[model samples]
Target: MTNNMTLGQRFLANEWSALAVAILVGLVVLASMSPAFLTEFNLYVMLRSFCVVLIVAFAQMLTLAVGHMNLSVGALGGLVAIAVGGMMEKWGFPVPVAVLAGLAIGAAGGLINGLLTVRTGINGFIITLATASAFTGINLGITESIPFYNLPAGFVAFGTGRLYALPYLLLPPVLIALALAFFLARTVPGRQLLAVGGNPHAAELSGIPRDRVIVMAHTLSGLLAGAAAILAVAQLGSAQPSIGVDWLLMSFAAPIIGGAALTGGHISVAATALAVVLIVIIQNGMVLAKVDPYWVQFLLGALILAAVGLNRLRAVRAGGA
Candidate 1:
């Protein structure tokens, strides 16, 4: 489609292109400033760290696509982490069984969120906020704020092992991103999801099940969140109550920066992937520059605002054109 366009036109038309350029620029700058930046060890570390964040972002992105928010993403993730951890460490469950149970729990949590929103006709923001508290309460009640150690050896190894600069952890997100892109662009249910988000009334008139799609989106969001939590457990070699404490911000940040509209019905898997890369680069650069870790929150907040403003401006210009 872009073959006939000029380079500038291509850049303007494809959101991911701009993100790719930004990532490239960030990589060059960081590599120059810190000799350690491009080393195999640092590269592996960055890749592994991004794996969980990318999945978490995708989880939130699904909810946003349905014109809703999932404030409970982090809380749900923390719950899943501990649940899976307890299953493995205390219940003598196998890894696969524990992982499946954790995902089921996440889906159930999401189901509650969906049913409440649909039944009560309350805004999703409110529904998710209330659920967030509920999820957190459950987590705290079960774990007592303690972490679960003694994860399986193979799982921990997969989280940390790498070939050259590529961590084994990188595989899941890559496959997931590709599958998501395909699903959104090509699948029937996927189209229905976006169609409902694009115009709920119109979709209903066209015989699409609006409530079902929203519920499905929420359920998928929870499943992905569960996957991310499990991965974090493997990476840390423990299931900490704090596993998802900081995910709320980054989960929203990457997808929004990737050009997902707050109003819904628009998202780009490729663009979101690039946005995650750019964010990871920025974080690594800060570490190399000896910046205070606390500043990351401020920076991410600022970046989100900037991205929203930029997107609004672009919309205005496009409308004008």
Candidate 2:
């Protein structure tokens, strides 16, 4: 395999490659460091742990694929969580109905973001960053600084219950990531998406709908975030104003480390899924290792920077260095 492949292209180009090895290595390290780490009970938690991150990772990957970044993903996710909780609790909506409302809020928010970015020509970073504050404030206001609690059983089952020993909600993110991978690599829209990302000028000249594409991207981002929020409520059995704060940071990091270009263009959804697993593994191992609590973010940041640098170096070489 080494003889047939360049270093940077190795993982992204092949499914059974370095990233697989990394996952295995991470598992081995975790198992060795903590005897309890590999049990079914803990594995369920690990899968659940990665679920939210995987959702946001896909959301960020989509935005970045279209040459943009959505800083509001975490905030928006929280907003949806609060919306679902408040709707069910205060507004007297049924659990399923409240969930639908949550999805509606997320989709509507994304539409506004997409329209604003497409129409106004503002930088996406600035737009989503502003939205983030707004979302956070709205979340705080909706909850009245108090957390929503004691979610119904139907909601909790999503995160806590299992089918044949697998967490129900956990399976969906994996399925989503796989479906996204197939879409991007094997579909017409997928290729068009890459063309739009790789060179918008050329894609526009070739008749691709640039504005529509971006809007769709943001819309999907919102959907994914909303779904994740619903799951968050399921897992926590409640909602909090700060529910999405930590995830906002980790979501962006996962895709970048998973082989997404920072400015958007090329990426692998399957790779992103693997990246989420790696992150979960790291976090789990950290807890088992009992290392300094503050070191986790530092470690993830450093890993992301390293991965991006490696990808860039490969791109440069492959482009004829």
- TM-score for all models, in order of appearance: 0.96, 0.92
lDDT string for model 1 (181-268, tens) is 8989999889998998888889999999999999998998998899899989988989998888889999999999999998888887
Highest lDDT scorer = 1
Model 2 residue runs over 4 Å out of place are 1-16, 163-165, 186-188
> lDDT per prediction?
0.88, 0.82
lDDT of 2 by residue, 165-268 (tens): 46887877878877888888898887778888888999999999998888888888888888788878888888877778888668878887777776678777
- Work out candidate 2's RMSD over C-alphas: 2.5
Q: On a 0 to 100 scale, what is the lDDT of residue 246 in model 2?
A: 86
